[model samples]
Target: MKVTLDIDPGHTQDEIIIRCAELNDDLLKIVALANSSQKKVVGSLGKQTFLLEPGDVYYFECVDDKVFIYTKSKIYDCALRLYEIEEKFQGTNFLRANKSTIINLAKVRSLNPILNGKIEVELENGEKQIISRQYAPALKEKLGLGR
Candidate 1:
């Protein structure tokens, strides 16, 4: 695949041209990443009350029927649900590690396999989360490892 970026000074906008002889998983991943970055999240608290930044978030979790964004400093309630947040952050280094958790791969420091088909994920901040076996395959795939 070949990617070409065309700049038009008069138009004040840039154009992207992707020339590929065949489409594969890599191409799909690139497209997904580009689309995910365009998604915006609106906080439930208030428009100006909380702004969610991808880098600042360690993970998104649904607990007690409420969605929360976990950051290094604090956690904020999100207007969107777990599934919604998962879709919005897809291809952005965030993966659904469990039923109620969407973890940032960039924030994961290490993974350890535990008993009964569960894996423990240790984040850079020393926080640990359990990744159910059902979602373990997906997490392994995202990490570029085979299950």
Candidate 2:
């Protein structure tokens, strides 16, 4: 689908207009996302809990048993398990880079195929995540790069 964004200073409020020939699953999800009022994930740094926008999150990492939300400037502890986070961010730009990590595809800078059959994903923040060989095919399919 071709997406266009128009920024007009004359408009009073931000609005979304979808022009499609037919309604399909992808269009339905797009409408659902647009109609949803809020999409947030809670993360904490010490006692102060912050509501973080899922879009700002670079990726989620599971170290040991804890899940941490990584952003451009800070790391916050998340209460959701890796799988739970996976389910919540479904249909969005989030993709499972590995068993222990969920990466936001919007933050991806590049994908490089490595010598060991794994894919190296470089994030916009310069941090790299490895997409295991087991999940590499799925990643390629999602990006429409697979045959």
Candidate 3:
């Protein structure tokens, strides 16, 4: 793989251009990652609202009826629904681990195949979550691991 960076003094915002003869899985992943929005997300802790970057979020989980975003040490209430969050972060690092949880693949440290065709995933923060049998294939595929 070859990488080249061109600096344009007149350009206001930075831009990336990829020149490839054919798009492969790795190239597609690069495009997905590069195309992910840099827009900040709003989450509230108690009564105070906070702006969060996507990379800082470890995962998003729904409990009962409320959705929360988890970082390494903090959890904040999110205004979006599970599916809405899922749709917004599509093609990025987020993956649906189960019906109620979306995980950030960037924060995953390890994966262990458990019984019942499930997968036990450990995040960078040492928190663990299980990938349901139905969703395991998608997670595996996203990670470039065979289902």
Candidate 4:
């Protein structure tokens, strides 16, 4: 893949054009990355607070009928459901590791396949999550390992 960046000082606004013969995984990844960078997290406390930084998030998990955004320092309760969060972060390096968990792929350090088609993911922050057999295929696809 060849990438070119052109900057014109004469223009007041930055313009980006991606020229590609076809939309492949690489292109999809680039698009996903750009989208994720622009995504904002709004807390459920009704204050409408936004978390702009992506690296500040450890993972997002659904537990006991509530959604929670886990960070390195704190955890914030979210109003959205697990499926809603999954849709928003689908192509943004976030995967549904299990029925109740949506993990940030960028934070994953290693993947360990356990018995009965289950897998354990080790996050960069040393947190672990189990990937159910049903969602393992999708996780593998996101990892670029193919089906």
Candidate 5:
């Protein structure tokens, strides 16, 4: 891959043009990073509201009737439903890990097949999430590991 930095004084905002014949996994990752939005999720703790970048989230989990956002060190309350959050961030790495959780594939460190056709997902922060048998195929396909 050849990277060129052209300095054009006329342009206001920087633009990127990727010249590739085929979109492969590596290239796709680059595209994701380049096209990443400045989007934030509003999380509230007590009475204070915090703006969190979607990339900072390890996963989103719903317990009882409320949804929570899990980051590296802290968890915050989120107003959106589990499915709504997933649908809003549609082309990104977030995927449904189970019926109640959506995990960021970028935060995953490794995937290991576990018992009963399930997968034990190890996140970058040393947290574990399970990919249910029903959702295992989608995870595999997303990671380009499907048959």
Candidate 6:
């Protein structure tokens, strides 16, 4: 696939045009990535509020009834519940690892099998999370990795 960009000084809106001879899984994935509607969410750390892009999130965790979104360097509290966050990023890069945590597959650096039928995933930032046995198969399927 070829990608081209046009620099229009007077352009008011951004647009993407795909010129392809045939559509395949790669093209479909390109479209899915380009057409991301859930671009950002609201999060707060202590007293400072900020907009968080899903691509920047390493994972989401629910602790003591509060939901926290983790990035590479910071953790922010979000107003949405775990279930809500799970539903929002369902078809995207986020996948549920357990009852209390949702992980971003894009941030994963390595995955290793554990003795308890679970998987130990190491994120790009060096943090690790355990994928429960119940969620292991689905995560492997998503990544096209054998169980």
Q: Which digits, one per residue and each the tens of the lDDT, describe model 5 over residues 60-81? A: 9999989999999999999999
Task: Give the worst 10-residue stretch by lDDT in candidate 2.
Answer: 29-38
* lDDT of every predicted structure (CA atoms): 0.80, 0.87, 0.90, 0.81, 0.89, 0.87
Segments in model 1 whose C-alpha atoms lie over 4 Å from true places: 1-3, 44-47
Off by over 4 Å in 3: none
TM per prediction: 0.82, 0.80, 0.91, 0.86, 0.81, 0.84
Runs of candidate 4 with Cα error greater than 4 angstroms are: 8-10, 44-48
Candidates 1 and 2 compared by lDDT, better number = 2
Best model per lDDT: 3
**Which of candidates 5 and 6 reaches a greater TM-score?**
6
- For model 6, give the 10-residue run with minimal summed lDDT: 30-39
Tell me the tens digit of each residue's lDDT in model 2 across 61-112.
Answer: 9999999999999999999999998887777777898999999887999999
Per-residue alpha-carbon lDDT of model 6 for 1-147, expressed as tens digits?
577899898999888788888878677766766654546867998899999888999999999999999998989999999898877776677899999999999999999999889999999999999999999998988888775
- Pitting candidate 2 against candidate 4, the one with the higher lDDT is 2
lDDT of 6 at 64: 95
Q: In order, what is each prediction's RMSD in angstroms?
A: 2.4, 4.0, 1.5, 2.2, 2.5, 2.3
Task: Decide which is better by lDDT, 1 or 3.
Answer: 3
Q: Per-residue error at 98 for model 3, in Å?
A: 0.4
Superposed Cα deviation of residue 83, candidate 4 (Å): 1.0
Which residue ranges in model 2 land beyond 4 Å of their true spot? Answer: 1-21, 24-29, 32-37
lDDT at 76 for candidate 6?
Answer: 95
- Model 6 ranges with Cα > 4 A deviation: 19-23
Maximum-TM-score candidate: 3
**Candidate 3 residues 38-97, lDDT tens each?**
656689999999999889999999999999999988999999999998888888999999
lDDT of 1: 0.80
**TM-score of candidate 1 on Cα atoms, chains taken together:** 0.82
Better of 1 and 6 by TM-score: 6
